[model samples]
Target chain A: MKPVIEIESISKKFLIPASSQGYQTLRESLTSLDFLRKKREFWALRDISFSMEQGETMGVIGNNGAGKTTLLKILSRITKPTSGKGRINARVASLLEVGTGFHPELTGRENIYLNGVILGLKKREIDRHFDEIVEFAGVKEFLNTPIKHYSTGMWARLAFSVAAHLDPEILLVDEVLSVGDAEFQKKSLVKMNDLSKNGRTVIFVSHNLAAVRQLCSRCMLISQGEITSIGNVNDVITEYTSFRDGDSPGTTDLTLISERKGSGIVRLTRIELRNSDEQVKGTFLMRDDLHIHLWLEAPVKVRNVKIVVDILNSFGETITSMFDSDSGFGLIEVEGSEHISITINDIRFYPGKYNISVSVISQILNHKYESFDEIENAITFDVENQLVNRNLTRRTGLLFLTPDWQIHKD
Target chain B: MAGYEIKPSGWLTFDFRELWHFRELFLFMTWRDIKVKYKQTFLGLAWVVLQPLALMAIFTVIWLKVMKPAELDIPYPLFAYSGLVFWGLFSSGISGAGESMISNANIIKKIYFPRIIIPASAALTALFDFVVTLFLLVLLILYYQIDVSLPRFAGLFSLSIMITMAASFGIGLIVSAATIRYRDFRYVMPFFLQAFFFVSPVVYPLALLSSDSLRIVLSLNPLAGAVTLARAAITGNPANWQAIFPGTLMTVFLLVAGLTLFRRNESSYSDLL
Candidate 1:
């Protein structure tokens, strides 16, 4: 079977300026235009390709500003791509935004006909399905009233019903379905599922991972304007989640964006905190081992240096302190560059925001303890209380690790 | 519904058959515009008649009573009102259509339909008002005891002239396309319309100009000859078939050129808007 939408080597490029702020001015605006031209280049979608067959439901998951909407707009024929080509062999319908084709002074009944024509439906076809469309919208009572008189929810309902009932062969849904209430959202999802079950192709774009997992049989992960992974829904979502968490603020490329400070003699070049499975994380359970991997660079030789990990709460209060020298942990001499690993097992912190403060000290001769460099609130994370059993129980205190439970019923 | 024949040639071509297929949509859009225009209007359709009537009264008083340069023994009100009807159709239709895309930018961005329907329907809405004023012209002409050549065919002849003037103003297509990106045209169009209203012989007759140079310059404006001929049609004067023929040809040329340019820019309107 041939793919219903054959998108081959489809790359969309945009001429976006480095400084694209829409400013209204004279001299500064001219200067900014000069700056824009100097730092602008073609932002290519980059050697990418994808195709989908009929009845296939594919979900596109990506970060913000990752060209997901641009790809969808090109497929919808709302905008032409700067390069590459694609073909769609289906009656495509799109609901990128609500209240799109509505006239303010026109009634709901009038707008439905107007939108029907906009969607390429003939007058006879609209008349045939008119009643069903109106009934689905739930605005039958306000059918003849001007749309401006209707509330926002009523407008959204009518807009959704018109696009939904049109029943195009392919549906391109953007993140606009979240406008309605939960019940309507459920109805719309059911409508989409029904469309897919009836051998219609659906391309859904959304940020909600759970919805994508529940609805899409195949999903693609987009990162930095490139398709990173595709295929099995679970594997793709897992890869996406890892990609998102691994790029969290303090974990990714800390050398250029580290919150720590140091003299030029030695600096915190890199840091990675991972779980037991070797997966980098920014969020963790309260009792998990907070294994920290640090890469430090020293310009000159240093000996007998101590490291400290300070845990602070959301209000900047230092809750606990774990010092390497205090625990009598042995330290080796470093000449230029060295790696250090610190594992604090069974962390017992309350449910709130916390940061790690790393410090280095020296035990040198003729001097007691000399401070090398100290940093505050470098890594931040959130903790959630463990909800083990729901027996209407309220457990107190931060430490609930390795709970000992016994029950006897005779 | 999905399959369509892609044009073999890369250049765009007019699809008159597709337009005919969507005739119902055109009619519906025109009806919607007409309804919303006078929905809560206090005077309703009477405002249409009152607009040209008031303009004729002012022109009659100012040009006849105040200026009184040269008269060919014609009723001042009839001459001025006739010119007002044709001029109103041209100015109001074109200007209304010129602002249609920007004013209705919401509808333009979302849907994929023949974008020409927007400006075309706006032009038609103004045409409806022009028709109401034509009814007043009929009453005024008969009341004034003006003689006509075959009064039965007078209305049909006037409609042909009115439509010609409307087509002349079909330059709105070009204006609408340009206004999407520049937006400077929106500010300039009203003053341009005002200047055109005077230069088109709406307030004065063609005979008022004694110089050959001025008459030749005025004839170059499509509406100047058309309006003069339409006035001659109602007043039983010898219709200047010479001037009317060339004027009609120019109006059609403008209409065709305007629509062609508009179609070229229609597909990219969303990006520019």
Candidate 2:
């Protein structure tokens, strides 16, 4: 029996504009010719080849820009590879993103047919599954109403429902379960689990390690556009976890980091991590006191300032968020520049790499709050395990806590 | 459905079988285009009929009063309205098909369909508007009690509309694909269409041009041939093979060129978009 998917030396090269300045792209389009434009070559996927058999559910885990999506795109024929070729022996359905072709002006019923057809399902099939799709989405009464009126959750649910009902021989899904309400996320995950159990070829690309471990029998880890590991789920995941470059630099010049989104009312200029001694450092031992020094510059007067820091695990799960207001210390004003020292008395995280996402928010009149600057994965640090307590040397949980125990025999 | 191979191919790849399989998608997309066209508008679909009807009325008054030409055998208003229907299909259809690719970038990036269908569906939305306006012509014909044979007019009507759609689809395919690379077409197209409208035999009949050279030059436009055929059907006049031949040839050329260019560039669309 032939494998459901086979490829030989598939590689994808992208020619990005040399100065890919978004501003120049639009302005130069009117003046310059296509051939005259300078472009820099970058390989998104490098000599990557893999085959999957029927009923084999493979999870593709990768960091951002790791070519996982590019691999899937090539398989799904959304984008042609720069070189090499591949063959699939069965019909393939790819959900690169849910609500792909949904138009806000279109009603839920209309969008279902539209999204269904875009996903390669036939009209009659959609008709046959119409009731099921509507029921699964649970927006039947509002089916005729334009989807613009639907809440974000409703939109995601309806989009997911249409995609979930698509029955194809091979499925290539990319983090579709990462959205929507928790219940809907579970429903789609269960549906995917059933798809694989029913012997359909599935390639799931996601950052959620737990879900990947649950739904995928085998796993592939990609780093810098190459497959670093592919085999047993736990082995691949362990290899992936080990590849994390945990020790980030002690300071980041926030002004130079252009990959940020906000109104820019008050811009963050620099961020530094220091130990209790105030010496600049990023790595820390468990239970060590840490100080996050944030330097801000406000060209204009900013009122009621707020600084928020979100601690995320290696799997992109938010462990907790710290806000200045939590200590009853916000509602400050800044004119030109201000240095903020957020002192954490005890860092109660277990040994692992954790990401620190920073956000600068402003409180306006009428109790309206808007984040002016927010950067996900702005800084990352390693938490080294220090066996302060001999009994808890082998930590099993993500948090380090000292709980008083009352010994009793029942 | 047979699975497809994913490899880079050169210039021409026509997958009629794939297109046949995606026929439902084409219909649905066309339906979506037609459905959402007038949403949130005060008049809704009434705008579709009103556009051509109003244009026909104004053109009728202008041609009759300003030109003050010698009387023709066909009624001026019917001549002008039918001509508008023919022109409308070519103009709006091409425009729709031309903008289809760039406008539907969301679906194009996420999924694969016959790239031709994007333009085809956009043109179909315009054709839907054409059909809505065609009803006005039928009314004019009934109101005038014009001696129109059903079968003969039907054949000519379908043939003319087919030619017009081909021309629009062909041009749309070229323009839409080109617009992806060079945005100049987005601005250049409106001027081209306005100029094309005057050049075609829409508001004025071919007979108005006394010189054969001018008449033949106008026939080079596919819409002129469509207008000639549609006029022949509406008035029960003998088909003008002399005027229709050149435009038909251009339509075939445009269709071939459009398909070839669109296919060649389609593979990289997701990236470019």
Candidate 3:
């Protein structure tokens, strides 16, 4: 079988300016002798090459900033590569983002037609699928109402329905199923599964590993703008997870991370994981006393500051969150540098790695709190159970419980 | 099944076959623009006629009452209103086409279609507005009792509108492509059009310019020729072939230049936008 999509040695280089100025005015560009010298080259993708068969369902898994979106854009023809060549033998439909061409002022019916045409469907094709789209979206009652007036869920449903009805030989989806309600996401996933089952090629890019494992027959892992592995779904996922655990589970530098969001008034300088002996450790036994230390800094004295810590499982889903206010810890006033520690006596996490995310919020006035700093997936640690008798299998779910049983005569 | 090769083509190589395949999208986009324009307004389609009629009223006060020019064979309102109709088409069409790509950056960033369709659809939407306004112009002619022969009126009116549209599309293509890279054009466009309004004979008769050289230079603006030819058709005055010829030639040149520049930059739009 021939490959439906063939990509050769493709590379894209973006001209990023060295200075902070986003764009230059026409006068400055014409008059300045240093105009050409000011720009630096940023290679978003380098010598990337891949090909896919006509009916294969492939999952593209990567960390943030891995150039996954750029690859999809090239395949969709939204942007062309700076070098090399590619070819697509079938009509391509890409859902880079849901509600891409949706206009708030247009009615739901009108927007369906608009989005359909934007997806490369003809007017007659849209008409043939109009009833199916409206019925599937369940917005027939409000078809004539402008989309701005619809509830957020209704709006997402309409957009997803319109995109789901796109009948192309190849579909390129990028994390669009993560939106909408849970039921809708499930329906979309099932629809995609059905499409692939009926001999349509699909390239799905998402952070949801479980969904990827479920829907894709093959998986490809990308790292640092290069494809590291491509093979069976299970093997690639294992390679990816193991690589991630081996790479950075030991330590994380807070200053090097630029993905954080918040005001710069207060900052989380560092985080440390320690045991009862007060020594930093990357692995722990089940039910061990886990101590988490946080270092913070503030330029001025701040009042009513709150700290929040979240524990996320291997799948990046938050298992639990610790808000200082939840446990009757009202607030702490900090002047400059402060060290805080929270210790849990009996940790119940199963034998798997977990990631920690931290955030700090300062209450400025009555009933008003501003996020000062937040770091997501800042650090990761592993948990191990030494007892062989204990059911330490990975399939025992996220929690390790201690139960009491008594024998009674019935 | 058709195979598509993804590579950069030569600057002058435009795929008209690809554009023909996406013609339905062009029509849908134009329809969407027209529907959205009229949907929110209370006056709806009435605003189409009211805009030019109101502009004619202002010009009548300024040129006819305040600064009276040479007496005309036709009523002053007919002359000014006819010119306003074509001028409205040119100005709105060019600006609309210029801003089309930027305003629809959401669609341009997400999907791929013939990039020309965005500006082309904008021109078509403007044409729709022109046709709607022409109905009011015909009523004005009937009200003034101008002897308009149907065959000559149809020919001149269609030719004049087409010329203005061609020029607008040409300018629109160049401006739209340039605006993607240099946003300063967005700010300068209004001022340029405002200055262009005076240079072209939109508000006054072309006869007011006494020197023959002056008329020739001004008539190089396609809108000047289009308005004069349209006015002459309605008023039954002898057409000025000398002034109209230069305008027609300039329109053709602009069309070719606009399409060439637009095609040269179309592939880079997704990156720049």
- lDDT by residue (A1-410, candidate 3, tens digit) is 78999989888888865553545567666766546666788676778788999889999986655778888988888888888788999988888988777888899999999888888777888899999999999999999999999998999999888888888899999998778888988999999999999999999998777889899989888765678888899888766655233334445556665446577568888778889998888788888888888888889887788888998766655779998788777556877888888888888888887778898887546857798788766677888887547677557678877689899999
Model 1 per-residue lDDT tens digits across residues A1-410: 87778776666555534554322223444555754455455443554578899999999876545667767766776655655677788888776766676788888898888777666567788898899888988899999998999887888888877777768888888876568887777778888889999999999987656677778879987765678888988888666543224357436444553223344355666667777666788777767777787777778887777777887654334668887877778466656888888887767776655666677767545746666566554566666666455222123544455668889797
Instruction: Provide the clashing-pair count of each candidate structure.
Output: 0, 0, 0
DockQ of candidates 1 onward, in order? 0.15, 0.55, 0.57
Interface RMSD of each: 4.6, 2.2, 1.7
- Give the distance in Å from residue A408's predicted Cα in candidate 3 to where it truly belongs: 14
What tens-digit string does per-residue lDDT give for candidate 1 at B139-175?
A: 8878987776666346645655665545644678878
Candidate 3 reaches a DockQ of 0.57
TM-score of chain A of 2: 0.76
Clashes of 1: 0
Runs of candidate 1 with Cα error greater than 4 angstroms are A16-48, A223-225, A244-281, A287-410, B4-10, B72-74, B149-169, B245-249
- Candidate 2, B76-184: lDDT as tens digits: 8888888888888888987888788889988888887777788888988988899889888999999888999999999999999999999999999899888887676
For candidate 1, what is the lDDT?
Answer: 0.71
Off by over 4 Å in 2: A19-34, A243-273, A280-283, A292-310, A321-343, A356-380, A384-397, A401-410, B210-212
TM-score between candidate 2 and the true structure: 0.87
- Where does the lowest 10-residue lDDT sum fall in candidate 2 chain A? A18-27
